[model samples]
Target: MPKKFEEFKLNRQILNAVEEAGFTEATPIQEKAIGPVLSGQDLFGIAQTGTGKTAAYVLPMLMKLKYAQGENPRALILVPTRELALQIEEQVRLFSTYTDLRTVVIFGGIGPKTQKEQIAKGLDILVATPGRFLDLYLTGDINTRSLQFLVLDEADKMMDMGFIGSIHRILEVVPRKRQNLLFSATMSDLVHKIAGDFLKNPLTIEVAAQATPAQTVTQKMYAVPNFKTKINLLAHLLKDDEFKRLIIFCKTKTVADNINNFIARRFGEDAVRVIHANKGQNTRINSINSFKEGNVRILVATDVASRGIDVSEVSHVINFDVPIVTEDYVHRIGRTGRAFNEGIAITFYNEAERYYIDKIEKLIRQKIDEEEIPQSIFIEETPFDERQAIAREIDAQKRKENPDFKGAFHEKKKQYTSPTKKNNKKSYPSKNKKRR
Candidate 1:
């Protein structure tokens, strides 16, 4: 039997908000993480996305904070991406609604003046991306001396995004004696290293092995022949009303934009939206808000932009491209089957992507079921240019694994041809004989 939220002995303000938010029972991660957090212990949590990890940290932090106090923030939550920072800030607001705790979210891609003004007005909790947080701290807009609680959410993603230096800088600025909490979906080596720097004898919690997908999500894959076939299959899938709310994850911004344009043309402009690093902050926010609010039926995005944006009851997650980073496969599919809701994750891959699929399966410790594409959906033949591109990519990956292995594109060096014997003798023998 699972424990109820009441067992955690949360304060009335937090309890009311939890109830108002319609969460009666604690998730596995939440149940396990809350107690340690409330006890003011340094904690390192290993839990996947959609495991209620946000509330696991947020609820207890709220309980610890109780009510807002001074001008400087007491609790600081550092996230890897702007999307995550905004999402955490939203969670802070939702949970802290019944209390007087004021929260602000700060990230880049926008003017700092507004954020500085918000900081000036005083906040109890600050959720920020590393660069923006450090910027404010360096400019004296944020004071870290009074910080009591330091949380690094999505620590693995932070490391993947190359925020280690910024994280180190932050660790230096914050009070050395403060409580630390580090949460990540996967406990990679770098995550462990950073955790060593942040946490002090932390209670380690692992709800599940890292990189495992939620059981509620049915995973399957289509062996697509080319990009056009992926688009065709995507169109086929979206025709079903069961996939009313969907997110298509692409590997790069260029791919994301192309997919978004294709989807927009097929479905009306209002029916589809896209988000990536190149998008304006407001545009990204509005796109996410629209998708969350169900005003947009589909959102095409890159992996980085999709981090920390949560929408409950997402019908499906479609991987338009195989993620080179194997761990990201788990995060991408995690967008669906959230909160124990049944959902589906469909992946489209060509032959070249098989290597990544194998890596993903190995990391997750499970095989993704293969699905045969229906004959009605035309499979585009691999064009010569595209074929060569894929061959080169595969060859490159092979070379990384085995430097001595020559690839499909590798051609034997042309045999050096010596001049004909008679011609060489005629040209060189007279001078050589004279010298000899």
Candidate 2:
């Protein structure tokens, strides 16, 4: 029998909030994680994404943190993306609705003035991205000396986002004796290295097999030759009314923006939304809020939008481009098929992407069914020449309208590398010079 939330010896106010929020049984992660966390021990939890890990950390943190003071946050959660930060904050809010556990979500991409004001007012729990948190700390806007719990949520994703330095910065300030929790969907050597660095004889819990797809999701793959053909297949899938709600993942923000523009022009603007790291915080929040409430049917986004998306009823997840990393494939499809709900995932692969298919399959330990294209696509589809012409025209228009759009993390990294005194290009440190 699974442990139930009501069985825990928690404050009446928190129990009331949990009951009001419609939670009864604890998830597998929560069942295992909550006990150790509540015992005031460090933890290293390695479960795949979409496994209710947020609740695992929050519930116990809330229970043990009932001594919750008014202003400075007692617990701190560091995540990689703004979306994940917001999602975690929202989960904490849901369970602590009736309690006095004040929570705040913090990230970059917006002015810190508002966030500084919120932090000054006091928070019991602070969810933040490392970059923004470091910035705020450096500016003396927030203090971490009172923090009792520190959580590094999605630590692998944070490393992938090049935040190891920021993590080090935060580690310097947080109390070393505090309860530490490190959570990651995949347990590779790199993740394990960080976990070992932070945890001391901590309890480790894993709910699902690492890198495996959720049991409720059915995955399919389509092999195509070129980008143009992939675009045609995407258009065909989008037109199908069977897909009530869909999320299309692109490898690059440019692709997401282009796809969003195309969908917006073909369908109603209200029917499609696009988000990425470059988008303002309000735009990202609004896009997700609209998509959650059924106001928008399709959202084109990059991996930045993939984390901490909590919509339970998303009908379909389409990978417009295959994720190069095996771990990302797990996180990408995790956007759907949550909480025992069934979902469909479709991916487009080409010869260059065949390597990715092998990696993803090996990680998930399952063979993805090869999907047969709809006959209607062949029947009504225009000639290849005409389609290519139209596609090129659309591509040209997008280029003209949105010139110099950033592609992916790597692309943006290259574009923004500081110029050297010798050349107007990224500078590299001399090996002779000391790094420290």
Candidate 3:
């Protein structure tokens, strides 16, 4: 049995807010992490998304910070993407409803004028992406001298986005006596390196194994032959009512757009929306809102939206493409099975994607249950170009495993080239040779 939130000895106001937010029992992460955070100790948390990790840190931080204070923020939370920053800010507001703690979130993709103005006003908590935070700090709009708490949410993602330099810069400017908190779903080498530099004798808490998917989420995989066949399978599956409020994750912007168009044509346009890096900030937010509000049944998106979305009761999460980043498979599936709700996670993999599937299984420490293609759906033949691409990818994977192992593609290339062809060609004089 899990512990209750009241056991944490939180203030009545915060308890009320937590109750209003529909949380009564503390999750494993919250139960373990809140105490250390309240004790003013550095913490390193290894937990997946939808594990109540946000509230785990936020609640304790709010309890410590109490009410709003000076003009400069006392607590700074850094995230990787704008979506995640906004999501964290929303969580802060939701948990701080009973208190007067002012919070603001800033990111790129728009003008910084509004963000600067918000910073000018008094705020207790500031959530921001690394780039925008650095931009504001460089312009002298941010004051880190008053910071009492610093959090690196989704530390792995930030490191993946190459924010280590900015993080170091921020560390240099901030007061050295503050508490540090780092949270990540998966602990990569980069995350480990950052932890060495960031935390000081921190308490490490792990609710689950690194990169492990929630047990509440039932996992399934389909051995798809080609993209078109995958589309057919998707169409067949979406016809069922059980796929309510699902996210279809693609590998690229082009695939996301294609899936969105196909779904729109099959279903109504209002039933689906798509988001990727190319989409504007407002557009992305609106699309995500529509999905969260149950107005959009399907959200076609790339990996950018994987760790950022925080919707509850999502019935399913479909991996339209196998994530090349194996750890991302955990994050993508994490969109569902939130708040202890039972959900389904389905993945589609082509011949080339099987390699990634193996890696994902190793990372998650379990094999995904494979399902056969439905008889109602037609499996299209692999196109010649696509077949060649898959072959090349397989060759690349082989070379990655064993550099000396050249596959059939290499042999085919060798077969096409003539050894005497080079001798038949006219040779040009070297630049160093003097011409007469």
Tens digit per residue, CA lDDT, model 3, 1-436? 8999988969999999999999999999999999989998999999999999999999999999998888999999999999899899999999999999999999999999999999998799999998999899999999988999999999988888889999999899999999999999999999999999999999999999988999899999999877888998999999999888999999999999999999999998999999999999999999999988989999999999999999997999999999998888999999999999999999999878999999999999998999988877876766555665776799899999999987856765564233344432322111121112
Which stretches of model 1 miss by more than 4 angstroms? 410-436
- Cα lDDT computed for each candidate against the true fold: 0.87, 0.82, 0.91
The whole-model C-alpha lDDT of candidate 2 against the native structure comes to 0.82
Candidate 3 worst ten-residue window by lDDT = 426-435
Superior candidate under TM-score, 1 versus 2:
1
Candidate 3 overall lDDT versus native = 0.91
Candidate 3 lDDT at 13 equals 93
Q: TM per model?
A: 0.93, 0.85, 0.94
Best by TM-score: 3
Which 10-residue window of candidate 1 scores lowest in summed lDDT? Answer: 427-436
Instruction: Report how far residue 416 has shifted in candidate 2, in Å.
Output: 31
| Model 2, C-alpha of 91: deviation from truth (Å) | 1.0
Q: Per-residue CA lDDT of candidate 2, range 1-436, in tens? A: 8888888867787888888877788888988888789889999998877788998889889888875596788899999998999999988999888777889888988888899999998888999999999899999988888889999999989888888878877888888879999999988777887887788898888788887888888999987655556777888888888788889999998889888988888887999999987788889999999999999999898998888688888889999988877789888888889877888999997645776788789888889999876654432223333433333444454455678643222354554334344532123222121112
- Cα lDDT of model 1 overall? 0.87
For residue 347, what is the lDDT in candidate 2? Answer: 95
Per-residue error (Å), model 1, residue 177: 0.8
List clash counts for every candidate, in order.
0, 1, 0
